[model samples]
Target: MKHIAKVVELVESKKDDYIALANDIWSLAEMRYAEFESAERHASAIEAAGFTVTRGVAGMPTAFMAQAGRGGPVIGFLGEYDALAGLNQESGATACRPAADAANGNGHGCGHHLLGTASHLAAVVARDYFAAHGIEATVRFYGCPAEEAAAGKTFMARAGLFDDLDVALCWHPSVANSVFMNATLANVQAYFRFHGKASHAALAPHLGRSALDAAELMNIGVNYLREHMPDQARVHFAYINSGGISTNVVPAHAETLYTIRARTSPEAIDLFERVKQIAEGAALMTGTRVEMVFDKACSNVLHNDTLDAVLDRNMHAIGGMNVTANEVAFATEIQKTINPDDLANASRHFAAALRDPRPIIPEILPYRPDVERPVTGSTDVGDVSWAAPTTQCLTACYAWGTGFHSWQMVSQGKLSLAHKGMLLAAKTLAATGIDLVGQPATLRAAREELHRKRGLKPYQCPIPGDVTPPPARAAGTPAARASQDVIA
Candidate 1:
């Protein structure tokens, strides 16, 4: 308890510094693997804080690791700092207003700005605790980028970055504060390209074999597969390229990005195979050739009750966030921007835990036992769980009804309420890391639980060996190209 209190006080003293860093990251608003400035800011801060920094790790320019102390019981903290595309909203505005520069601009709508900062702050506090107590435990901070579109941690996992970790801790900014007992879906993202001969539509219509036709037919075929797939399985697609705008000419090439998700990696692979078959049939019917370019994939998260209990204990010991009256007023205004139906749905969803309707959540929810609830969404953290025992918690950073990946979330990202929540999350994670370091028996129990659950099934990276991380969009590199000639 004394050590935990010291950690909490340390995080409290540095709250303003981290909040400023979060604001800086929010303003930069870099997306995906191109987060050079955002990553550098974090790396520089931790480097000055006494942690040795290693940059350009795992074949990623923005991916890096910072470490302190030495020896066994290595506890790692995962941080993300990628912004979503087209969510740029004016900061601190209650109304929907895009940034003046562009109608669709990038912003930290998913709260990764705070997400990355809180984790790093926790690692710093843990490192300070280790130095103060003369503890010989190792603490690491992972600067993971491109979590929005690309599975950065999945790529790092394949590179064996997390293999030496005894346990890992992470957190996300959300509407409620609680440990995640639910597991996220495993998914694969890819681009399906179709190529064919081009010809003048009005003059040589018969000579043209339209690739656009093949893309459309492929989408229809996959839609029909919905009924045959398991209820938990999901398939989605977006037309990345549809030949050209000239209707007078028959298109020669078209492409659609597809994402297939299922409860497990094997299930996702099975569904992906079925989708490929459908693409072949579409190409055969349209006289066009099809190519599958593998982008990336991530496995489902493996939950550990032993690790969850540690986080829950730390969270209770730290207590709830101290939100100010002005912060509450700001949150109340943000809540007004939400749709009536959304507010109603949120009320119904959290009715069991929340007794009264409020703009900001004022209490920490109890940790519920794992019921295997379906998360439906995907994250790169799932891959880290497979590499080492991992557990994550959520903090009340946004208004109760504020949906994620929206302008509303972007607006409140740097507010006082959000800062308070971020500080509390840092305390929670720092305390958890301290506990895991001091209690070697707890780490043993956690590792044994992870082993028992895994049994004979060992982890295999979901991404293929041939695939590499995508280059920045400005660099003009295609996400993935066919390894072999098109199957015809």
Candidate 2:
């Protein structure tokens, strides 16, 4: 609170440069782990702000951590720099434009480019605030990579990289402006590879054991399992490999990638184990040997009442950024593109965030603190929340009702409106960090809340014991070529 004005001024001073950073990330449009240029850009900014950089944290080449200040109750500002596949589009306009000759190239459909810059600005501003005022709390900026596949944070949590942090901060680029209260599903990703001998289908069909049959049977089992599971439990799968290209051959090798999610980590783990049983049974039914490897997993967040209270205070200070009449009309047009079911969900979500007479277009979002149930979606920040008393906010970085992982998101990430929202986030987060660092009681309360929830047990990784990252299953498989076929 002491140097908040100066801190805000610092962020303002870097405002144009910050927006440029967001645009640079948007233009780069790198995919998952391949975010080399984006990583360097963010790391360089933190370095310029007088933070020491720790490159390649959590055994990831692109992932790094930057630290400033010098004491406990270390605050972390998380950033993600991954883009979605096949979402490439030029800035502005409703029409589609790929970055190059390729039709379905990488693009920032999730607005992670904004995600990285907003939180980075928060961290840098906080550091500058401390430097100007002689504060004693340490601040960390995490340059997390590959959030698209959920790879980065899980490994960071596994490596105990976040254990020392007292609190973590994260935010996503979204259509609405608000602090979400609901918890996310605990998720686990794995691949079920079925192995068997191959033979000519036309000549010695009886001698051949088709692994494809096992994979198909596994999928059917999961589908049937849906009826028996709780309404909240989610089971999803994709046939990543289905044996030979030829129809005449009895395929010897096949695989199915699977993801299982549930309301809590324990519930998610129980469900994942049950799914493994189904996989084994399917393999037995098809005379194939089953081997499974988990790709990555994330635990559900245990929300902190203390952190949320401070976040709400800050959210009220920085009032919402209003959308123009033309933007509202644009949002209406985008709303039309959504399916009725998705449109209903988005309307319900946005309506809850706004308390106006006729949906006032959500400039400053209200913070909701009392959500008991979990949302269907999952996030790696969910893992960070379990590690420390973490709070995340959603800003209006995209148009209302704009779809995630679509051309709409990629188009709007490069818009002027998104630029405004990014600046608001930078200022708010920087002030919040200064509040915690300069004053000790709030941090104490936040830490107490974390300990109270965790008790004697430590923060646990939600992924099953054997689960691995999914990138290996499709490694060197050229998903870019596959994306081309989809768009073609």
Q: Highest TM-score: which candidate?
A: 1
Candidate 2 TM-score, true structure as reference: 0.91
Please provide, for model 2 over 30-64, each residue's C-alpha lDDT reduced to its tens digit, 9 standing for 90 to 100.
Answer: 77767788899999888987889999877676799
C-alpha lDDT of all candidate models, in order: 0.86, 0.75
- The 10-residue segment of model 2 with minimum total lDDT is 479-488
lDDT for 415 (candidate 2): 73
lDDT of 1: 0.86
What candidate 1 gets wrong by more than 4 Å, as runs, is 101-104, 347-355, 370-374, 475-488
Q: For residues 1-488, what per-residue lDDT tens digits would candidate 1 score against the true structure?
A: 66677987899899889999999999888888889999999999999999999998887899999999998689899999999887889988999888675423788999999999999999999988888888898999999988986899998999998988999999999887878666688998888899988999999989999999999999999999999987678999988899999999899999998999998888999999999999999999999999888888988888888999999988988888777888889889988889988876664433135667688886788887734353547888999998898988888999898887899999999888788789888999999989888888989898888888778466689988877887656322345442433555
- The collision pairs in model 2 are 294-467, 294-468, 295-468, 295-469, 320-363, 320-364, 321-363
Clash list (residue pairs), candidate 1: none
For each of the candidates, the C-alpha root-mean-square deviation to the true structure, in angstroms, is 2.2, 4.7
